[model samples]
Structures are given as C-alpha cells and as structure tokens.
Target: MNETLIRWLEEREIADVRSRNLELAKAFAMVVKSTDQVFDLGCGTMSNFRYLDPLLSMNQNWIGVDHDPGMLRRSEPLVPRTRVQLREMNLATGVRTLPQGPGCAFTASAFLDLVSKEWIDQFAAHCKDSPILIAMSTAGQPEWSPIHELDEPIRLRIKSHQNSDHGFGPSLGADAACYLVDQLRHYGCRVIVRETNWILDSRDGTLLSMMIDGIERRVQSVQDPVDAQVWADRRRLELLKAELRLTVRHLDLLSIP
Candidate 1:
C-alpha cells in the first residue's frame, strides 16, 4: 500500500469505528475460544488488530501478514510484539501459504476489494475449516451530501479504476464481498455481510481530503486529464470551504465453515 494511503487508513479508524457492525464483531468473537490463533491478511499497519483485540476476550495469538516489510516494521510499535507476530508474505500468490492449524480465524480489513474472484475462491478453499472476517470493502456507492453534477461520472470512473488489475488479476472491486460470500457458502461455510460506510464531514477533514485525492487520481487515470482536473477542482473547492460531506459505502463479511 502507498504510505499516504496507509496514513489515510490510520486516520479513518474513527469513522470505521462508527461504521463497522458491532453485532457481527461480537458474533465473531463468540466463536473464538481462548488460545486461538488469528491470521490477518494484508495486515498493513495492523489497524485491524487494533480494532479487534479489545473486543475479543481470548488470549489469542495474532499473525500480521503483508508483502511490505516496511509496513510490518512500522506496525511493530503499535502491536503487542509478544502476542502479535508480523510476517512477510505475498497474498497475490495465494492464501494457501499462510500458516494453518485448528482453532484459527482469518481476517482482513479494507483489503478484499483489491483482489480477484479467483483469489477469493482460493482463499475460501484454503481456509475451508476456519472462521473468517473480512471488513470494510468498497461497495461502489459514494454519496456527497450536497450533490455535484459530476459525482456520478466520477464515481463510475473510480469504479472502473477499482476493477483494474492490482497484481492478482482483474480486481473484483465492489463485487468482492458478495463473491466471497457465495464462494465460501459453496465451500459449505455460513456467511453474513453488513454495510460499513464511512461518514465524513468537517470533523473528518483529513480523511475527507485524502479520499478526494484518491478519487481524483483514480478518475484521472480513466478519463481525459483536463476533465478529471476540472472535476477535482470543483470537489476540492467544496472541501476547502468545508461544504462537503461524504458517505463511502463498504461491506463487511463474516464466514464460518
């Protein structure tokens, strides 16, 4: 992940707290027992661990896996090193390489949208016996409180960008969660999905700004440069005036096999 993107995720934790489905999290926690081991894929800076550790009562061991060594190194200070182990692994190859055992749970946050349908199927196949929680995937719906004429066009462009290959094959983007649910169920797992949207306003200015930048960048890649810049300028003006509020729709999925 980009460093700026990682920082944006860190900043957006507050919004995630408000948007995440607590009931689902509690349900997942109930399924976990003491001394269980949880593996977090694309763990990045370990924000998923930060959000879940307190909710789970088990004296569980956590393995944070990421392809980026820098991310793993950066997460060291934030996580309890004794109970949390950070490993370097490339999820792009497949999830089969992840450590496996009984009483293990698999998790990832804000990650599935970047993977392909094939990758998710492989993930389900490998973890057929483990309970899984995948959170905060983009749902291809973005709403601006004070609507802009360019909003829909921009959104479409961003969605297109989302589906672009991210090393694993064509990304499933917004369709990832639903695909995972179906694939996991095919593998005989029970799955539940819930919405987890980020509601951003002036109070979340930093994250809001970062989101605009990201959207604009994605749009630029797919549209004429001049048109993209104009759209971005209009959005940035609203952002500068503190006149914009954004709702970024995402989905969270839980699977028990």
Candidate 2:
C-alpha cells in the first residue's frame, strides 16, 4: 500500500484521527497507573507508546509485543527496559494469554484494523479480565471525517481498492471501533465510544503519496497499463500542486466491562 498516501491522508486527518486516542489513553492511563502491569499489543515501532508513555512515565511495568523484529529494536531504545518490555508476537496468531499478568489496561493503536474478525473476537475474549481496553484508530467505514460529505466517494473507493492490497487484513474499515464497541458490549464490556475527525494538512506529503500510490497499485492490478500510467501522472501533478488537505476519520473505543 502507498504509505505516503495513507500518511498524507492521515496527516490532514490527524486531528480527528487521534484526538480520541489521546483522550482514551489518558483515561486508560489512569487505570494503568493503578495496576501493576500494562500491555500494548502489536506495538509496531512503539509509535503507539507516544500515546501511552505519559501514563507510564512513572513506575509501572510496560510491555509491548509485535511480530516485527525491527519495530521491537526501534522500541527497545526509545522506552526504558526498566519501565517497559518488548516482545515479538504474530498478531494474526494471537496469544491465548497476555505476557504480563492481567491488569487494569491493554492498549493498541492502528493495530486492530489490520487483524481479522476472528482475531478481534479472540482478543475480546482474551482481554475480558482486563479492566479496560483502549484501541485507537480502529479503522471503520461510514467515515466520520468532517469532510466525509466531500470525499466520501473517493475514500470509499480507495478503501475498496486497498482491500485487494497484499496486506489488507480483515479490518472493518473506519468502523472497527464501533464494531468493537458492540462486541465488547456483547461481551459485557461497558464501552466508551469516542470519535475524532482530523484535518490533515500538506505537512504529510509522503503520507499522501503513499495512499495514492497504494490506491494506484490496487487499481493497476486490474486496470489497463496506459490508463494506469495516465492516472499516475495525474496524481504526480496533484501532489506537486501541494496544499492539499485530507480528512481522516478515526474511531477509538475504551472498554471497562
């Protein structure tokens, strides 16, 4: 997928995208602070740590797990081992049990969207004992971006196109948070739904390029060669023009069942 485009799109939409996550993290942190342990799953590069770190700044055992070795390496240096621990785990093949003993909170960001439906159910079950689950940017559909009215078609089409991408997992686009909310509630979780609509500005050029590139690649998978080339060229010009803003619809769910 075109990470540039995704990043660009996300940059414009960052405000709405992660606003709830920050809030959720703060709330979850309160619970984490009271517990002996905290967990961050699929801790890709520990980028999610930025959200949870403030809560962990004091003395709490922080553990982050991911299948990606590189992300673990990057995270190890950024987070203190005394306060934080890192592990490798294939999120698709989830853990029947969490690494640290059950605690007040388990946090994940953007990771939930990449997992399959089966994984989510399993996750809900595994995390049942934990007091709170904070999932940020559970990608969903019926995007709630402020500009959803304007880019609904494009966003919808792009999401559809990207579903065919190599790594497109079974995430419920833009609505994972909402779906999880329902599931957690079904599982007896008292879920708190907080949604954010972020306006991404041009600072995220690489992000935009990535999204467009990912889309272009998917479209090219079935499109004519010449047509694909033309679209590619057109996208190039659009990026060159700059000042293009995007709205990212992000949904976050906090559950304490």
* Candidate of highest lDDT: 1
Name the 10 consecutive residues with the lowest summed lDDT in model 2: 141-150
lDDT of each: 0.84, 0.59
lDDT of 2 by residue, 51-89 (tens): 566665476776788776865775677787787889887
lDDT of 1 by residue, 12-31 (tens): 77788788888888888888
TM-scores for candidates 1 onward, in order:
0.93, 0.76
Q: Against the correct fold, how does model 1 do in TM-score?
A: 0.93
lDDT of 2: 0.59
The C-alpha stretches of model 2 lying farther than 4 A from their native spots are 1-20, 99-104, 138-157, 161-169, 222-229
TM-score of 2: 0.76
lDDT at 78, model 1: 93
